[model samples]
Target: MPQSTPSVVTIGELLWDMLPDGKKPGGAPANFVYHAACNGVAATAVTAVGNDDLGRELVSLLSDNGVNVSAEVNDYPTGITSVSLDANGVPEYDVVRGVAWDHIAFTDEVRGLVEQADAICYGSIAAREPQGTRDAIYAMIDAARADAVRFFDINIRSGFVDKEVISRFLDGATILKINDEELPVVARLFGIDMPDESISGQQEVMRELRDRFGLDVIILTAGAAYSIVMGHDETSILPTPKVEVADTVGAGDSFSGAFLAYLLRGYDLATAHRRAVEVSAFVCTCSGAWPAYSDALKEEQA
Candidate 1:
């Protein structure tokens, strides 16, 4: 076997968000891969696209951003979601179904590439379709277990995720990320407490999740407030930096990508946490999910 490369592999849907102005390439996996590349982590996105114009444009966009799309399929029409922005510029999505991403067929090359990765990032939303793509994701997870750290960003979209799929992904995950609201839902699914007060209570909730799921790291984001990072023995709170918001479209995904990028680079949890905050804040300053970075913004920490 060839030597394994220090790269992150993100697997999920790749599609365009039909915004009020036009279409923008946006999906959880694609957004995460974009930030991973921006942070200087060699990253590839394993996803499927359609054989249509939207798919071609998405491929071109990924190429221009230096994200590898070699494992991307073009068998069906590209996936698309309609975005309706609220007064505060937050987007509510109406995701279209039966797109190419719903039937993602994994090739031998995709399996090989995943096996060579240092980390793999996936989410529950992508696993909630057609059953074939979900199986493909599981196959990659099983094959990459020895070499890759599986980071499960449990992006539970309504009408998509169910209890069984979330439980299965958690069983295979090394690290997990979820928002404050989703935490309670997941805890209830696992029959844990529905807390009402205090960050300590929240920490306990997270600790229970880690202990039950065998998680090495658990990240919980409380929007516009502090985020919590919990390990087996340590727990720390990192504050979200105040910044002018363009949109909150991919802030969570960017945070997950940056955190993984820093951790894989051998940074301590505190350092990684800080880096995640900074990178996420920078992303929120721009309109798109994955914002273009300047050289200064991409500077590596010593």
Candidate 2:
């Protein structure tokens, strides 16, 4: 049901991740939009940045990498997160507060883009901030076409999400992307008690969530183990491929991006699920979230 070129828009934070070695461009929505564009979509990132050198460089980095950047220049300094990688390459973030992205505005241009977008992705991090930006994100989703793939990637960070906020986003989402680590949090937030923590138990929770929210699709990713995709009538489960890890900074975001990209291109559910797993596995072996596509990745998309 997509046009010739599926147009995708991601509305959320745009910031630099201060990793142990150095800084890199990151933010769930920005990373998602970048990977979506890499997989052959017209992808745009909508967020705010400071009127500073870092902000200009961040915008330029995204633009140079094929993502259309629609950023509001504001007075607050650009956002940054200190990322510390554990022994297994998992990341723990200390996110800076009161940054530029907390002040995202709803301009006419952003409204038009959202209205026409074939798919839109947003997360909880940016919406957890000052009230105006949260309202703006909701407005953008409300303006999207009724059939648009309103993807809600519940990127829950500490002190950023609660039951009320999660429920509000679920009420509007057509597709929900969650990971194993966040699944328990979501279950508790929704008051869905999980007596069994096995794979089947998780799928039951996913099914209940899908039915409750009237969601068309629900993707549950378990890092380094497996992933599951539950469609309206079918379910696809695939084990995660083993790969050497640089860091897991954006592997999950890459999975969401690649899955949506394949779906938009008319691939079947199973095939899309397989390709997304491959893409995320490839991302795991790379350094940052937006790595250059290797031949293996290109072939997987083809």
* Model 2 alpha-carbon drift over 4 Å, by segment: 1-3
Give the alpha-carbon lDDT of every model.
0.82, 0.89
lDDT of 2 by residue, 1-302 (tens): 44698989998899999988888999999999988998889999999999999899999999999999999999999999999999988999988989999889989999999999999998888888648578888898889999899999998786676677778889999999998878888888888877687899999899889999999999999898999999987999999998889999999999999889888888888988988898888888887778899987787676
- Candidate 2: global Cα-lDDT? 0.89
Q: What TM-score would every model get versus the actual structure?
A: 0.94, 0.97
What is the TM-score of candidate 1?
Answer: 0.94
- Angstrom error of the Cα, residue 124, model 2: value is 0.6
The Cα RMSD in angstroms, rounded to one decimal, for candidate 1 relative to the true structure is: 2.5
The digit string of per-residue lDDT tens for model 1 on 138-217 reads: 88788785756899999767567588888888888889998887888888888999666467877888888888888899
Instruction: Candidate 2: give its CA RMSD in angstroms.
Output: 1.2
